[model samples]
Target: MEPVEINAGAYYLRQLRADRKLDDRPALMEAFADPRHRRYVLNYRLRTPDEATEYVTLRAAQWACDERCSWAVADLATGRLLGEVGLRDLDLDFGTAEASVWTHPAERGKGIAAAGLSAAIQFGFARLGLHEIAYRHDESNTASEVVARRAGFTRVGPEERPSPSGETLIRWVLKPS
Candidate 1:
């Protein structure tokens, strides 16, 4: 499925093109360099423009697959990359998917992540015919939990993932009203 652009009030959501049209390399690298972003996002630190190019290229490619779709959340006026939001691991039969979002450190506390996530959820439910979306984040990441709750998700419970960090993931679910 081809990804589509969305108007999200102060922000907009568009496909992350690896091409010059979207050219997110510099901004992406800067965000990854932030220690706080590195801790919560796990978006990983990119070493160079080439690596960033590859990163966005892969993210952009996810739209063509059946399981995931991502959008670059940008400031409407500046067109600067504010963050990213996605509906991933989609279960078409079950009408469900997982929501993921991360905002640049500089854009934090501005509601970019929450707004972007809400827009993605709307698209998934309306366009993709999804019934529910799950949001999960590290237990320590209060910011993400706040975003989830603000977007109308209800806390479900804790989930365990096999990882060296002993990560405790908090899970929340949102069903269509």
Candidate 2:
């Protein structure tokens, strides 16, 4: 898909370009290392800096894939890495994919996730030619649910399955018009 730019209130969304180095690992680690953020997302375990670096590297590789499944959210105003919004488990033939997003703790409640998610959903539907995009979260993650809803994703259904932490999760999906 060609790169897309989406306007969301004060923020704009563009494809995460490879020209930018993923050198924000340390800051990202510190942000995710926070207990509140980690508890809800990473199950409260703070990864070591090295471990965080490895994870970011792996994620960068995923983003670099030709399929356009992942992207980093940048702050157009300050040019900082605000968060990430990504599509995974892509099924091109099926015209469907799964979506996930995260914002740095410092950036939460500033509409970063909502803007980023809106841009990603638009990209999926308009640029990727996807018919549907699914967003799943732990039922307890009210924040994520809010993002999905604000981005125009309906609560289509639910799924009960084990999370990365060995607990059950309730999943949700959204289809494009």
Candidate 3:
């Protein structure tokens, strides 16, 4: 499938380019290594270059297979990788998917996540003919809550799930308008 690109004012949203995975690895690893950025994310440990490469490779495959629609959020002027926003667990039959966003530590509080997430939602609802898109984050992640609100998602209350730590993770979702 052809990758979709969205011009989101100061930032742009585009699929994680398979050809440029090598160049994107270092930034991704750095983002994962930062404590503040890693806390709320699942399976986000400090990664070796090889691990980052493997993860990026899988992301490319997932996108190609239409299992996920992850994109690299980048600054329009410098083309720096700002973060990522995506739809996962995409169920074409049900027209549903889970949305998520993460910003690089240096790029937080700039509305990058909100912009990228909004663009991804637009793609899911319009291009994919999605009936509903859900976004959930750990209840403790106030930052994600802010991004969800800014992206125009409405709260649908809490959900219980298992976390990487083997503890109950209480999360909440915002459904598409």
Candidate 4:
């Protein structure tokens, strides 16, 4: 499928193009290193720049032309990497996929994560012809729940699973119509 640039009310959503280098690693590390991001994301610690780069590079390669992958989100006005929104565990035959996202601390509360997630869900359902898209969040993350609701995702159920922090977490899923 061809990558598209989608326009939200305040931001534009585009694929994480190969030509564009990931520039938000430093900021992401800084923000994610904080407890706020770590707690919600179930992260134990922030990764180094090299680790972040490697991870994103791998994801970029996977999402470039695969059925299961995720995309990066950037600020159209400033060209800054605001966050990432992606689909994982995509079952093409079943027409379902899992979604995830993370936004830089400085970019939060401005609707960036919501806008990016809206674009990603649309891409999954419309562009990819997916029957359902599921978004999961840690139960403690009220902020994530807000984003999910704002993006039109409904809570389906809860799941207990191991996280990077080595703790079982409550998970919520949203299946969009």
Candidate number with greatest lDDT: 1
Top model by TM-score, which number?
1
lDDT tens digits by residue: candidate 4, 62-163: 665665556557766766677777777778778888878888777788888888888888878887778887777666677788888888876766655655
Off by over 4 Å in 4: 1-4, 15-22, 42-46, 65-67, 160-177
| Candidate 2 residue lDDT tens string, 1-177 | 434456655666544433355355555676787776776676333357666556655665665563545556876675567887877777778899888888888888888898888878887788778888887777667898889888888786556566665654656667776
**Model 2: lDDT of residue 117:** 83
Poorest lDDT segment (10 consecutive residues) of candidate 3:
167-176
**Model 4 clash tally?**
0
Among all windows of 10 consecutive residues in model 4, the one with the lowest summed lDDT is: 13-22
lDDT of 3 at 20: 50
Q: For model 1, how does the per-residue alpha-carbon lDDT over 1-177 read when each residue is reduced to its tens digit? A: 888999998899987755656577888888888887777666455879988888787876777777688889998886789898999998889999999998988889999999999999999999999999999988888999899999999998988672224578889999988
Candidate lDDT values, in order:
0.86, 0.70, 0.79, 0.69
Show model 3 residue runs off by greater than 4 Å: 17-22, 162-177
List RMSD in Å for every model shown. Answer: 1.7, 3.4, 2.4, 3.1
At residue 148, candidate 4 shows an lDDT of 82
Residue-level error in angstroms, candidate 3, position 4: 2.0
Using all chains and alpha carbons, the TM-scores for the candidates as numbered come to 0.93, 0.79, 0.88, 0.80
